[model samples]
Target chain A: MKAVEFQGLEVQYGDMPALRDASGSFETAAMTAIVGPNGAGKSTLLKAALGLIPSTGRVAFFGKPLAEMRARVAYVPQRASVDWDFPVRVIDVVVQGLYRELGLLGRLRLSHRRRALDCLERVGMADYASRQIGALSGGQQQRVFLARALAQNADLYLLDEPFAGVDAATESAIIAVLKSLRDQGRSVVAVHHDLATVPAYFDRVLLLNRHVQAEGPVAETFTPEALARLYGGLLPQLS
Target chain B: MSALDFLAFSAPPMLIALLAALACALPGNFLLLRRQALLGDAISHVVLPGIVLGFLLTGGASTPAMMAGAALAALAAAALIELLQRSARLDPGVAMGATFTAMFALGVLALELSGAGAVHLDVEHALYGNLESLIWFDATDWSALITPATLATLPPELFRMAATLALLAALCWLFWRPLVILTFDEGFARSLGLPVRLLSAGIVAAATLAAVAAFAAVGSILTIAMLICPPAAARLCTHRLGPQVALSLVFAAASALIGYVLGGYGPLWLGLPASVSAAGMIATTSGLILATAALWHKR
Candidate 1:
């Protein structure tokens, strides 16, 4: 099933076009990596997909509009974009993921707290639940964000640059978690920067540079020619 | 002085000041968390012109009339700042500085042109306030306190501060979760389908109300001080939002009490003849508390 579909999407910052006439679809139970050079609108495409930015487009989830199915979607923005020095505990951030279910005045039940702790355990951050978020390292912060997304229990997860500055062990752990989500028949779309790990980590790749350059299974679409076209000829040899 | 005389003379002003401090501190935490402390400063400045306009139109400094004018002026100032930032693409600080200074200057000019100098509508009163003057002098006897006439004789500023505090407390209680979520992570809050726009606007309005309500007693400078300092001090004390808010309220109340006592009596203790400006003293106390908290945290 098509978990998310974008048609004729366009986003502009001032006079410059960030994503122009972009269109694509992601199926359920697949790990899709959006790969591109810097300024390639990879983040912009994800934001526009969720209508976080002003964009002219039609975004549907499972044949329904995004607004109607917003509760079923989880988004983890780039760690670099947030203020790490903010005064909040690790558990506080994880609880924010349940805000939708908690609503404005809903109390946090013991069951909800247990679920959040379980999500933290899944991301290996249970020990740091009481620590301030700013005290964590780069990789630990990324894992905390993943724990937040995990607590949402959404059917579709959209992550932006989750592996931008993590250690090798943390990277593999994150990949393992994503693969588990895929195995559970959930869609996981990530804005990925490391090209070397594309085929190894992702089942599908969407090459982007202000638009969808090439998109399909890793073996078919992530070709040297397509990557060269997307990266403006600064292509690396890939297996 | 006897205990009754002390209660009659000092307690009213102290309570009023404490309530005013709390009113500003509650919403101040969210403003500080959102990194919009300057917005609170801007609202305080812009509301001056509204107060002057309200005085001119009504020929009396009624709370409702002044509050209405101040609310309108605050909204305009906020809108102007936003417009300047978006349309002219100016920096937020520059936009806020421009709009607030112009409005404050207009307020000063209006005070001058309207011949309100003979009244209590001067720049000194607008900025420094007259906290010392809000005395409950109508209670001639201790029995009058329990009588219905005591209600009629209570200082109007006291009622205004109490009402404002109550409203602010209710708002904070009702919207605590959404406000905390939005302040911590706005993008996640938006993705959760929360009414981000409405929540932002509500916070802005609440801040404006606080500034205006505290204007008559604490003035704009003290309002800004109370709004930013206590929260900052609280931030230094705790890493959690709930604890931070509770600590801020405690800090605010402490500032108000200490400031009032020091301003009213510390000069006599120092062998001086006169008291000091209670509002100014309160602002200074809040700043001192914040500095102490920072130092203590570093230790």
Candidate 2:
């Protein structure tokens, strides 16, 4: 089943087109890496799919509109977009994932706290649950965010630049977590920048350069020719 | 006068000031967290014209009329800031400063034109309120406190402030989760179908209402101070939102009581002839508290 499908997705920032008529589909039970050069609208595509920004396009999840299935989707924005000095504990950030099901006035019961801690544990951040979010390291902060997403228990996860500025251990840990999600038949789509790890980390790859250059299984679509076209032949090593 | 007389004269205004401070401080934390601290200043200034307009239209500065005017004025100020920010591409600070100054000037001009300068809605009272004038004179004796006539004698501003506090408290209690989530992460809150716009509008309305209710006793400047300083001081002491809010309330109450005492009686001990402005003293006290907290936190 298709986890997310975008048809004629167009985004403009004041007159410049950020993403021009991009169309693609992400299949379920697999991990997809949205790879592209700088200013390639990789983040814009995820934001558009989640309806976080205004774009002229049609997006669907499980053959239905995103609005109807919003609750089943979890999103992790770029870490740099958040204020590190925000006064919240690591556990509080994770508990926010349960905010939807808990409703406005719903109290966090012991069961909910346990589930949040469990998610934190999944990301190897259980020991830092009581620490303020601002006190964590860069990779630890990213893991806390991933823990928050895990607490949501959404079937489809959209992450932006989760692997950026992380140590090798964290990079492998995140990939392992994404693989675990894919093993459970959940869909994971991430905006990835590194080209060397594309084939090894992701099952499906969508190469974008203001539009979809190619999208398919990594072996078939993520070819040296596609890299050359997307990168304007600048990536001689890949080519 | 006896101690009872002192208590009777001072308790009502002090309570009113405390309630007003609490009302403002509750939402102040959210404003500080959202980095919209100047919005409080803007709302307070713009609501002056609304109060004046309400007084002009009603022929009396009644509570309902003043509240409606203040709410409308605050909403207009907020809208104008947004308009100027978007259309003129002005910085948010510039837009707020421009919009509020213009509204406040219009309010002052309206007061001058309407010939309502002699009333309590004058410019002096709007900027620095006469808290000492809110004295309860109905009780001939302390026994009158139990009588129904005590209600008639009680300052109406006190009840208005108390009611506003209740409403603000209820709103904070009811929408605590969404407000925190939205302030921290707007995109995530929206993706969760949390009605981010409506929640923001509701918070703005509550802040306006609190500012309006506090206007008669504390004035706009003091209201802005109360809305910002206590929460800011509390934030320096705590990292969690819940603790920050609680500590802010405590700080607000302390500032009100201590400032009221210092403004009203401290001058007497120093051989002064009259008390200082209680609202000014409260604002100053909050500033001092914030400064102290900042120094301590830095240390």
> Residue B97 of model 2: what lDDT?
90
Cα lDDT of model 2 by residue, B190-275, tens digit: 77877877787777777778888887677877899999999999999988999999999999999999999999988998999998
Q: Per-prediction count of colliding residue pairs?
A: 0, 0
| Alpha carbon lDDT of each predicted model | 0.88, 0.88
Identify the leading candidate in terms of DockQ. 2
- Expressed as tens digits, the lDDT of each residue in A94-183 for candidate 1 is 998898888778989999999999999988889999999999999999999999999999999999999989988889889999999999
What does the lDDT read for residue A11 in candidate 2?
A: 94
lDDT of 1 by residue, B106-169 (tens): 9778878988667766677777777777777876668767888775677888988999999999
Worst 10 residues of 1 chain A by lDDT: A230-239
Give DockQ per model, in order.
Answer: 0.75, 0.75
